[model samples]
Target: MITAIVVALLFAMLVIGTPVALALAVSGSLGLYMMGGTPMLMGILETTPLSTASSYELITIPMFILMAEFVVLSGVADDLFDAAAAWIGRLRGGLAMATALAGAGFGAISGSSTASAATLSSTTIPAMLRQGYEPKLATGVVAISGTLAMLIPPSIALILYGIIADVNIGDLLIGGVIPGLLVTLTIILTVAFLVWQDPARAPAGRSYTLREKLSKLRVVAPLLLLFLLVTGTIYSGIATPTEASGIGAFGALVLVALARRLSFGAVRASLLRSAEATCMILFIVLGAHIFGYFFTLTRTTNDLVALIGTLEVSRWAILAIIMVGYLILGCFMDQIAILILTVPIVLPVIQSLGFDPVWFGVLVVVTAEVGMVTPPLGLNAFVVARYTRRPLGEIFGGILPHFWAHLIVIALIAAFPAIVTWLPSTMGR
Candidate 1:
């Protein structure tokens, strides 16, 4: 009953527009008090903040955020889109395809989906619009492509999942590579199909000469090198994910400096933004730890796992139900918040069913990618709408095809976990 009340209180606070971190902290503390008096709550509060903030793994968040900020400020995203356009712009719906390809490339550097969305919106949407591409197609491609960042290596979403699930952070990062590429390929194919259905919706872009196309590659070489350095180090076991983040940040800093784009203002802005984002995530972590303490005291996960063991349903059915629940929740909540809040509850059950946590981590992020563009609170959709000034309805409608693509990708990963596990398994071998 106490567990039920605490969970109810948490949801009540969320429905009333309470900040997620605060909602978690308050409801958890209240639960702790109800069960074991003020001391238990106080003791938890005193330790959780320190412990959560002090996690060394958490350093990856800020470094990667700062690296992304630097890369954005350096105008590499513009060059990335341009480079992709040069290679693929001659095809039907070519610019839209370029946007997807560039989105995946940008995801290699910037792990934040909304950041990827905003950047693509500024760079690709106008280019597509100027080319006479349909607004719905243009905006939809940008919004959906943005989600590639969530699955790609250096992905903030996967990093958070790793930290939360106590899984190998390196393996999780490596695991995301193949799945991310698969998503990129699927998104491109979706664009191709959309254009094929009505070429008028996305006319072919100007053809580029060999010289011009080759020259564009020069612009992206630095970004490519940076990506190889970061991921290669981790895969080769030369650096942990956290150390690789520092290397990535430093490399981004150097790239900005070499381009003569570095400035006091840019550096300061990057630091401040990184700090702001880091603090927000840390607070969420703190709240999750507090709530987790209360939850563990309730033995909810263990009981839930045991309850599931007695059920006669096939494990696949249970897994599908869980995936469906994530899709529903993804529409209403932030992806990171969903992971932090739900992983502790669901992971044990997943393990009990004989699923690999690393594979499950990749699957979780893939589902979050779908949520980023889903209605009501599709954060990526909002970001696209903000940048393009399109109606939310049109943006949502535009993403309909891509939304189906995401569902298909999710289904593929679920059916063949090897897609997610293969590359990671090869790491260090």
Candidate 2:
């Protein structure tokens, strides 16, 4: 009953719009106090904050953010987007399709949905509007495609899940590569199909020569190199995740200079943004640890396992039930909050069922991608709406069809877990 009350309070705090970190901290602290009084609460809170904050792996959080910030401001992403437009803007709905492709490129670097959505929406929407594309088509594509940021490598969501679930972070990241590419392909195919059926939505585009396309690729070379550097080093076991991030940050600086895009102003702004993002992520991590401590004290995992055992259902059915629960939560809550709150509780059950941690981590991220595009609480959708000054309803309308693309990708992964598992298994463990 007490565990039930604590869970209810936590959900209440979330529903009332308290920051996720604060909601977690308050509910956790309360549970600790109730369990063993003031001294216990103080001990748990004090140690958790320190230990969680001091993790060496945490250093990469700031570094990754810094790399993304510098890359965003370096004008490289705009170059890439323009290049994509030049390459594929000739088909019906080609511009919108290019925007989604560009979202994938930017996502590969940023590992952030909001950054991908805002950046692409600002650049793509205006151009698409000028070209006579429908507003909903333009906005919806950006919102849904931006979610690829979390699916692709160096993903902040995957990093958090790997940490929380005690999986190999590098393996988890590598595992996302195939599924991420599959999602990108599906989105592109969806765009082509939509455009083919209704040419009125997006007018036929002008063709570009092969020479022109190759020439445009020259401008975005450095950004591609940086991706190879970071991801390659990790895959080859030449650098740890943290070291790769540091190198990536340095690589970003070099690219900015070589491209004649560096300025003190950009550097300062990037630093400020990185600092702010790092603090927010760290606070959530700290709060999760605090909440996890209290949750363990209540022995919830054991209870949950016992409850599951009572049901004579197959473990596969149980997995489906969990996925459905996550999807429902995705429609209403923040993805990161859902991840932090649930991983600790489910890790034991997952192990009991003999599920692979890395594969499960990929599925967790895929499910979160659905939330990034869903209505009412889709962060990427909201970012697009705010930046484009469109009604949230219109954006949600645009998102509806593309949303199924996300579900299809998830279903594909669920049917063939090997898509996620094979790459990680090849990694040098």
Candidate 3:
């Protein structure tokens, strides 16, 4: 009964256009009322948001976000994309491949999927279109590749999953490396395959001399340094993820200053944007905590776990089902909301079935990456479409091959847990 009310209220709020965070909070409060009456509901209202927002690790989110904003505003993305283009743009469908690689590099610092999509789309789509790249392929590459922001290290989603699941944040961060690279390689190969099949759409390559290539490297040098500093600090245990983020943010500011891109106006704008994004994410997290607490009080998660345990399905079968469910849900929901709202319920079942929380976290992130490219609610696709001024369908069609690439990589990760676990485990996490 409590579960039913909570579900209904949540859907009702969503359907009526309540902000997602508020909807979660409202539904959670209603669930508490259903389970423990008014006083408990009020108590939840007081404590849950405070507790959820008070997390020290979560501080990394806004700092990383700020770093991304500075990078974007400071024109780092353009330089990075140019560097990628100089090296790879001579191959068939090279621009698209370059976009994917650039997305991976930007993902390192940005950590936010939507921001990545928006920033990269703004930076790359216009150049691709101007270069006579097919609108569908160009937009698709940008949209799908932007999903990398979530799989790469310093990802806000991975960090949140670690916090909620009690998994090591460092391990979760390291765990993303292999899967992230796999997705990148898969997307690149998919682009190659598509270009081979449809030669007309494949533009002739632009040849660059060795001097040109070497000169372009200068454009990306700062980014490489920033990557080393952030990921290096974390992996070396020189700083926690939060401290690494702080260092990265400071580094970004310095980069922007050196690039002569930093101004009082840019700084103010970045801060405002960061604050807005931080509020949206933190609010959803707080609401999810309330909802999770209410669900626990109603014993729904425990009941669901017990019921699933009674089923005759194998653990892998159940895992497959959960991934499919997340894929469908990802199409309509924001990834952060999906992670917060579902992880609490799904994770217990996963653990009961004897899966490692670390592995499952990576699985969940990769699945959510698929959602970012799926249609209707695919935030990345929408952003790309808006930036390129292309029809949504074209962008959707273009991203299809890359979507399969993501799926193939996901399968590899599923079949071989070592792919995702090796780095983090070797790190002794």
Q: Quick one: best lDDT, which candidate?
A: 1
TM-score of each: 0.99, 0.97, 0.97
Models ranked on TM-score: 1, 2, 3
Please list the C-alpha lDDT of all candidates, in the order they appear. 0.92, 0.85, 0.86
Give a tens-digit lDDT track for model 1, residues 1-429: 999999999999988889899999999999999999988888888888788888899999999999888888888999999999999998989999999999999999888888899999999999999999999999999999999989898999999999999999899989999999999999899989988898889988899999999999998889988997788899998899999999999998988998898899889988999999989998888999999999999999999999999999999999999999999999999999999999999999999999999999999999999999999999999999998899999999989998888889889999999998888888883
Q: After superposition, how far is residue 15 of candidate 2 from its true place, in Å?
A: 1.4
The ten-residue window of minimal lDDT in model 2 covers 420-429
Q: Look at candidate 1 and tell me the lDDT of residue 47.
A: 80
**For residues 1-429, what per-residue lDDT tens digits would candidate 3 score against the true structure?**
668877988988887778888998888887788777889988878777678888998898899889888877778888888889999999988988898899999898778788788888888888777778778778888888898989998788998899888788888998898888888888888888888989767686688999999999997878888987888788878888889999999998989899888789989999999999999889888888887888888788899999998999788899989999999999888888888888999999999999989999999999999999898888888888777688888989998888877887888899899988888866732
Ranking by lDDT: 1, 3, 2
Worst 10 residues of 1 by lDDT: 420-429
Better of 1 and 3 by TM-score: 1
RMSD (CA, Å), candidate 3 to true, equals 1.4
Encode model 2's per-residue lDDT on 106-192: one tens digit a residue.
Answer: 877778878888898889999998989988888988898888889787788888888888778888878989988898888888878
Error of 1 at 320 (Å): 0.3
